[model samples]
Target: MKKLVLWMVMAPVTGLCLSFMYSPSAVNHPSSKTGKLIISFRNSVDALPLELNKTYINSLQEPFKVTRLKYYISHIELDNTSAVITPDANYFLVNEEAPVSKTITVPFPAGSYHRITFLLGVDSLRNVSGAQSGALDPLNGMFWTWNSGYIMAKLEGRSPASSLPLQQFEFHIGGFQGRDNVLKKISLAFPGGKPFVLKAGKTLTIDINANIQKWFQGPRSISIATHPSCTTPGSLAKQIADNYAEMFSIVSVTD
Candidate 1:
């Protein structure tokens, strides 16, 4: 009877141990329902790929060369047919000269998404949260003083149209308070309104084009010759922000 009781307990324990040892490891499983979403920014001027120091004409018919171009993208959200998924709250500095900085990757779950939305500038929360690290680091030159907040977008270059001494134009746009706010939220839908299907363990890349010309012409016409530099936040900055808010468009999506 003692041996029978011992065997009964040991049999189930042994079976449990064997089951755990033989079960497939979740980490090694091939059916993980997680994927990656890559967002790539392609800067362009008049439909041509942007190259630094290459002369291009703006909508105002002014010839200029971009010496530097940088902007912030944040608050990314993916919208599915049934739900909205915010992968994470992260800020990305897309530098026109930095190839690696142009691509942003986020871990996403398998889903059929139709729309992707993101902020073109850092949100007010992070702006008021004091100094930060990583992409929000002040050393990145995106942030102004803590009181002035961050530079939403910066464009610098030389143009004969510029009235500055060196024929240089600088647009350091920044503001987060009241009417000075230049934060822009941009939403893009897949081509043909088709659903973008992301499979498990696979990666999807979304190519976005930022037309530099849109900065000069959209709702308002900004003449480089007349207003070459806007370094502070005000009505001109807000107008520029409104113009650039329409700069991004979906170019393509690939697996």
Candidate 2:
């Protein structure tokens, strides 16, 4: 009787240990295990980098004052030689401030990815998908309550061409219908699959350059004098947002 009881107890314990060791969640494969990646937001205006530290604050150009800069990024897709890893509910918000930064844990199948593609702004589906938490939390201050959707992009600052009072430029770009709809897709290729590697406890870093010229590319230049605030989804907002989306480029990647 004593032997039988010991055996019964040991049986489940042994099985549990084996299950943990061989479980899919515990398995670490290049194509199975998930690796972490960090995404950072960099601010630039009129061809100069924006640093929140007081030292470089004075370096900003005359017409390019960096007041507020924010955007939404989600639906991460990683393309490797064998498969494409698309994680569900992957969303992130990028903002600028003192030591401003947002890090995302991009879980991939421990394999090397040759290229990556993502959306610059929230998709129309998730835009109107209603309340969410974490990166999608409305309380994070990224959503527009009056508009009933997310603010696709935000560029705020005071320029000489701007008007009085706030004397700033607020271009909030967002639209889910018609030609005014503006959601851009950005893709970057990693050759030789070098920067896409993942080792235990290692992290990959990618720096993307947001070119200021891209903001003026589509319809017309952002004349703060004429269009100062994007109270809603208007013409100037759409044009500037469209132009700015094209400026996204991968500057550097390190593992």
Identify the candidate with maximal TM-score: 1
Each candidate's number of clashing pairs is: 0, 2
lDDT of 2 by residue, 13-114 (tens): 999999988876633334435456666656664357765321122112235465677777776666632222333346777777534444555655455666
What does the lDDT come to for candidate 2?
0.64
Cα RMSDs, all models: 6.1, 5.3
**Local error of candidate 1 at residue 209 (angstroms):** 0.4
Give the clashing residue pairs of candidate 2, or none: 30-111, 214-243
TM-score for each predicted model, relative to the true structure = 0.84, 0.73
Candidate 2, poorest ten consecutive residues by summed lDDT: 53-62
The TM-score that candidate 1 achieves is: 0.84
TM-score, cand. 2 vs. native:
0.73
lDDT of the candidates, in the order given: 0.86, 0.64
Q: lDDT winner among the candidates?
A: 1
lDDT score, candidate 2, position 120: 75
